[model samples]
Target: MDGTPLILTSAERTRAARLLARFTDSYENSLTRRPIAPDEDRETLAKLLAEPFPEEGLGVDAFFADVVDRIVPYTTTIAHPRFLAYVQGPPNGIGPYAEAIAAVLNQNCNLWQISPAANVIERSIMDWLTGLFRLGPHSGGLLTSGGSGATKDAITAAIADRRTDFRERGLQENHAPLVLYTSDEAHRSVVKAAALLGIGLHNVRTIPTDDRFQLRVDLLMHAIAEDRAAGKEPFCVVATAGTVTTGSIDPIGPIADLCAKEDLWLHVDGAYGALFILADSARDALLPLSRADSITLDPHKLLYAPLEAGALLVKDMAKLRAAFAFSSTSSYLTAIDDAHLLDYMDHGPQLSRSFKALKVWAALRTFGVGAFRTVTERCLSLAARLGEHIADAPGLELMNPVTLTAVCLHMPGRNAEAHAELLTRLHEEGTAMLGPARVHEQACVRACVTNHRTTEADIDLLAERLIALAKR
Candidate 1:
């Protein structure tokens, strides 16, 4: 702690509460009318880069003013009703309060002793996830920065399972180069994870997908057999529960079976699509995810917890612990795990973690799981509504089957540049912020209905506008 006191007085604290309420009310009120993607503020950016800390403190009032005047205007409103550009979720009503409380508590959620309540909160969330996926007994996981980090850690666990001496030998021993397999449409993070773990990109096989954009199980088996013939040690298969581009789900059951036969660790990167299992419409398609050795999820996406909350669940908790556990002898650093609680530091790479689970838990408790189930199901319905419009419209093509909440559409003769122009027009007109997409190497546009605030009318508006643009 610093020698100079930074504590607020009772009067200041009361004023701070008033300021927060005013800001939230003002911001929320302006959201519907303001543009989703604000234009660049180069002047503000330059000032921010050049400015240094002041010798005198800028009190809470000035800080709030700066946020309201300078920061909020430039930031992209990710919570906007039409923010379907990426797989992002808006914050739930209770999450911001939970986040505030978590910050006030300042829990270093890495150990049980220091953050007993946090440990239980995180464990409880993971328990619900494990049971939801039906990963069987002795399954557990931890929250990471997001889906990318979770994927990286999942691969680390896979490598450790491949070689018992991985932690000790560090891949220096005499052994064939490890191979990782994934569909071409799998998230780029999987490739990055393999490369970072010293699994050469050459050994990472990009298996082809079927017509539905699902990984072709027959081709995967062929690739594994070819790798085996070449004396390559195939270690893991990364499958997608919901692929990013088209929301296509790979045949999880088939991929899991192949992994089982080949003795490869099966990891489902369910970052985009897995949580949809909460919705009845999506549950049957996602149920096969349970067979995987490990699964990645993002509560920040479907759960609508604040940003930067991703989780990785493994079939066996012991394997996960073995992969990341460190034996410490220092009295200050020593910790133990029990049925009631466990050290989160032993689950993943980071030692200093925030209390992300509180937001997730609080939101679940506040709104109830049934509420999110409705939101997800509604999102799926809205996407389908868009898909129907595209299919029925003239010169507009439904590029992919509306598998989840992503609807990819194309113009009959529009080139990549034309599609780019259309997206720019949408952004400029403040109609909606949609992302550009490609299907079969042909450019198109994709609208992902990940926001709970998005409605059937919003989808129809976008669809009608696209149809109008395609006419040009």
Candidate 2:
């Protein structure tokens, strides 16, 4: 096996080009219009995949054709404008093309020597983001897979920054019972991160939220005091800029003040709403985000990059390096040559990284930052319109305030199961794909207008259909 053939023949190269072209054409065409359900048999897919690996390869063209005919159909139509299910959106126009180019380059972006332009590009991107938050030159961060990974990494850094012995000894070392606090309205990622760090799910305190769905600052303060009185150390507080369920923002100004008074690390999960920092109305409000020690944002969610692009920014670059630069013991390569430029490996947990920055940089360059701002503003306005429509319609009630792009509504008399059915019907009818929400322990449907392609007509159509259903 070690002495096997190492090079591809001309036949294989031609076949590969044909196959790649076929799939690329298919993907490009689908993005031009609404995604309709494909009329194809799914059973044959299993049969095709079940066959053993051929002794003689199918070459490139056949493999590519099969992907076009068999694989693309089963994928979710996430790029469709009507896909308003979760806090997700269609990729920006340049995202796909940039991704393809990045694949061809195959730059291992972990080191500066391997990815000189990429290192500078990523740094420039991070610098621009830090400037948005009003963070000083000392601030720096790294990109992660998604918001979940960012939050986990931030919390890990917070633990290390606060605890003197956290480097060699983990949470189990002191057993001093350090506690972390977050609003009940925060995304579940916070709880999951704590549990992963062995912080004990029981030790993570869940503060209650107010009527507007914002984290209650008074309740948070009270909880911290009680925990301290009970002999527990309160070291960090995780706040939200845009929550998952209702898109409500916690009071960042007051949260920051409290963290400063108590000497606690403050981490803001701004994955869903941070890019709204581009929105003019939100720019002033989010200024307080600069006070946070760390922040999490997802380029995939609001920046309209393709899947799996999240970031974690820290006010102090040294803190980020101290938290993640543990596994630097590599003897296989020349270490000095890579250290001249910022090695992304020292910035995050992963070593073998991909050129994820290319797609993000491409989208920003092709469309410009102002374009994203307009779309974000449009989404917020669309959601506000949705909330108003729900309030005016009979039998429909606004479940939560329309703060960002998520608009949740509850039908007073409808059962939870019935609401789920309505969601299914809407998707089946090609109207839209919405998700269900449990607000105030009552069943409801949620519409997240995160797509740049959505229009006022789309918002009105959704409300009109729902009102008609309720009246029936």
Candidate 3:
């Protein structure tokens, strides 16, 4: 053969297709088919990977075999129905195919000229989300990596919108130290974002939460007044729609009122709970989201899209543009955009963007909003059931209210370390994978029913295991 680069020919394509089909089949059967206890790799994967890379390709067949033989077994099965850990669950049925299609197209979603349909699709998705929250006509947003990025974008926009001369002088300018506030129950992203933005940890105040784990509005108001009196610029207040540990919702309405009076930017970290607004009850609970200047939400968590699907929505879109659209950059390789098109580069920090909107749009269209609502509602109900079971059990105590989809339970007589041990035991037993959370300074095993695939039986199995563990 000549020194020409080895490309996948017809035979290689057929082999690849067959290998992919096999992989998909294995994944589909993973739910009912459990891996062997003390699972062992019949082949040594380390040795295979440790070999030096060959300048000449091994061709497609050997590559596919290596992937199937070595890589597949060692991977944790997140798609498995029983694998419930952190705020992550299972991906929706259409998500995998949509993601594959996106990869195949490889559309750079930076501008409409490069990806016209993608730009429109993202805009449509954002419009739908904004309408869902009842955020009026001027509402717009940018798709982000995940909830962390979304929250960071929200905070950035808030800062940009509030500063009187931020356009001319960045945060580098010496001014009264800017302070931001969030409930103790808010996600750590708020504190991290503030720190990353040059707001010292000392400037980020963690307001106390009430018995329900919601932020105390009175305390927040007092903090604002104190900051004002101290000659500090209190710029933003981050309210949580769903906290990580307890799934507690902050008092957004009262918080918004304070922001309005104090002229503070209001950003809601709704990464976990905002999509629950698909449900009538959840929507009713989140009425205050519309009042916020900006909000962060994760489609990956609630919409059941594949990983890395988050969004930051602002009531006024210009604030987002003002924050990020400074670097006037042009590329000869990229097409020029018309006034009719949306240049997504102006929306967020990234100039090269992936077609993330495809999976989201595909899921929404395939399952429809009604299906998402039903799934979200089911997750909430399942959490409630699990919480009830934990409450009624002899040795277990519910750590917090199961407001959204998180059920935090602890063995009352034990410490955090013991709870952690129990969590390990459950995972080892193949019952489920539950995350450990510290709620109100107590160690608790946390199970978040965020998957559309989670069922009553799954909740029952989790509760049964907990009850058995507690009794022991």
Task: Please provide TM-scores, in order, for all candidate models, with all chains considered together.
Answer: 0.98, 0.93, 0.94
* Deviation in Å, model 1, residue 244 alpha carbon: 0.4
Name the lDDT value of residue 438 in candidate 3.
Answer: 82
Q: Judge candidate 3 at residue 90 and give its lDDT.
A: 73
Per-residue lDDT of candidate 2, residues 264-300 (tens digit): 9999999998889999977876888999999999999
Q: Candidate 1 on 423-462: residue-level lDDT in tens?
A: 9999989999999988988898999999999977888888
lDDT of 3 by residue, 81-127 (tens): 66667787678888988998998899999868879999999999999
Ordered list by TM-score, greatest first: 1, 3, 2
| Deviation (Å) of 110 in candidate 2 | 1.9
lDDT of 1 at 369: 93
Better of 1 and 3 by lDDT: 1
Q: What residue runs in model 2 are displaced by over 4 Å at the alpha carbon?
A: 1-45, 337-340
- Go through the candidates in order and give the C-alpha RMSD of each one to the true structure: 1.3, 2.6, 2.4
Off by over 4 Å in 3: 1-7, 35-51, 327-339
